[model samples]
Target: MQTVSFLFFNIILPIFIPIIAGYLLQRKFPLNVATLTKIQFYIFIPALLFTTIYQTELNSALLRDLILANLVLFVLLWAVCLICARLMKLDAGKRSAFINSVCFYNSGNYCIPLIQLMYHTPFAFSIQIIVMLIQQLLTNTVGVMNTSSANRSWKGALLENFRMPMTYAVLIALLCRWLSIDVPKPLWTSFELMAQGLVPTALITLGAQLASTHLYLRNFRVLVSNAMRLLVGPLLAAAVCWMWGISGVVAQVMVICAAAPSAVNTVLLAIEYRSDPEFASQTVFLSTLLSALTMPVVIALVQYL
Candidate 1:
């Protein structure tokens, strides 16, 4: 009981306060979520990723394990979504949206801050950055291809990933690390400042997005997607951690990250590709709302397991 309370008050409450503010603020003034999203994608997120990766002491073993753990979990989620889609007899667009809603999670804005709050170590933060990168890569490449194949070339979807600022952020960080290229003090300071604002800005953006999202509580399909994202995800992640011998903070971060809600980007892609945007948005909103109840439990469980 104490553990659960601590998780809620210390961790969960801090995260949601800004989210609720964003939701209410948006409800009143109606901020442009797209502009906020671009700020996150172009400026804040890359800054956070670059600075964290450059500063963290990443080892080959840790990197390899993080990559492998994410991949295994991702593949498992993908397969499960595919089977579910088939069983549900969804059409092409809905199937694509369903797969994306189930497979891709909100690793960036959500999990990064959550990890930061849970563990104050650079190691845990680095693990989450890598996880976020893997998720973004897969979401942009495979997810885009899946959703846009009917109207665009897969090559275009593949190319779209390269255009993202995050792609370059990882490359530049790794390159600087490899070459021992030290960034100028002023530039680095700027990067740190931007990175520091990521948590509040991101949560606020998410809240605003939710405020604008049209909820569909009665949709059985949305519930199915929510079940996969919020419930099955942590279970699969726990299994994957056990399989990989991931223990301690690594295991905890991975499982908690797995329990995060669906990606907001999934809805953007669904809308862009003329897929089932309604379902995509509904899943994101519902899953995020449900995760408020589910995440503290998952956080506590990971601590014990």
Candidate 2:
């Protein structure tokens, strides 16, 4: 009871109320969700990614293990989504949107903050940062490619993915990290300032997207997508953790992170690529709003183990 209450008041509510505000803001005002999304993708997200990667003191061996773990999870989610899409007989755009809802999660704004609040240590937080970076890279590249391909050719989709400023930002950050290049203090501070605002920016965009969603929210498809994102996602991560022999804190962290909601970026990608943005918005809103209830259960289960 204490855990639930604390998590609700301190962790979940504080993190999620911004989304509600954003949602209300959209309903009241004439905000340009597309422009906000563009600013996020082009300016804020790239800054966050670069700053996160550059700041965290990542360990090579742990990073390698996390890469393998994340890779396996992504592949498994991909296969599961593909089979489910086939079974559902969804059209190309909806199929792509469905795949994204389950496969890509809210690792940056949602998941990272959860980890930070749970484990009172920089080490655990840093590990999650590494995972978040890997997830961000995949979400920006393969995720974009997958969503865009519903409308265009694979070649065009690939080109589109590479063209995103995020791809270049990630590459540049990585290269700088490899060469041990030290960014000037002023420039690094500027990056940090931009990156720090990503959480609210993303949540607000989610709310704005939710404002624009015109789909029937009380349907089998919406329920299933939410179920797959909030429940099946972490279950698959647990299975993969067992398969990979992950245990202790790392296993717990992975499970919790996997349990996060559908990425807000999914909606952005859907809107930008002319995919099923309505469905994506519905999935993201439901999953994020309901994660408040589900995440506590997941945390308790992790503790029990």
Where in model 2 is the C-alpha error above 4 Å?
82-94, 119-151, 168-178, 214-217, 268-277, 303-305
* Candidate 1 similarity to native, TM-score: 0.95
Error of 2 at 229 (Å): 1.1
Clashes of 2: 0
Local accuracy of candidate 2 as per-residue lDDT tens digits, 1-305: 34776667777787678777888999999699879878877888788678766656667776688789989998998898888889889998898899998888888667755776688655566567657766766776788878874555556545666777767786788799889999999999998798767778877776676676665667666788888888888898889888888777787888888899898879888989988887888888788878999998787777643
The prediction achieving the highest lDDT against the true structure is: 1
Clash pairs (backbone) in predicted model 1 = none
Name the regions of candidate 1 deviating beyond 4 angstroms: none
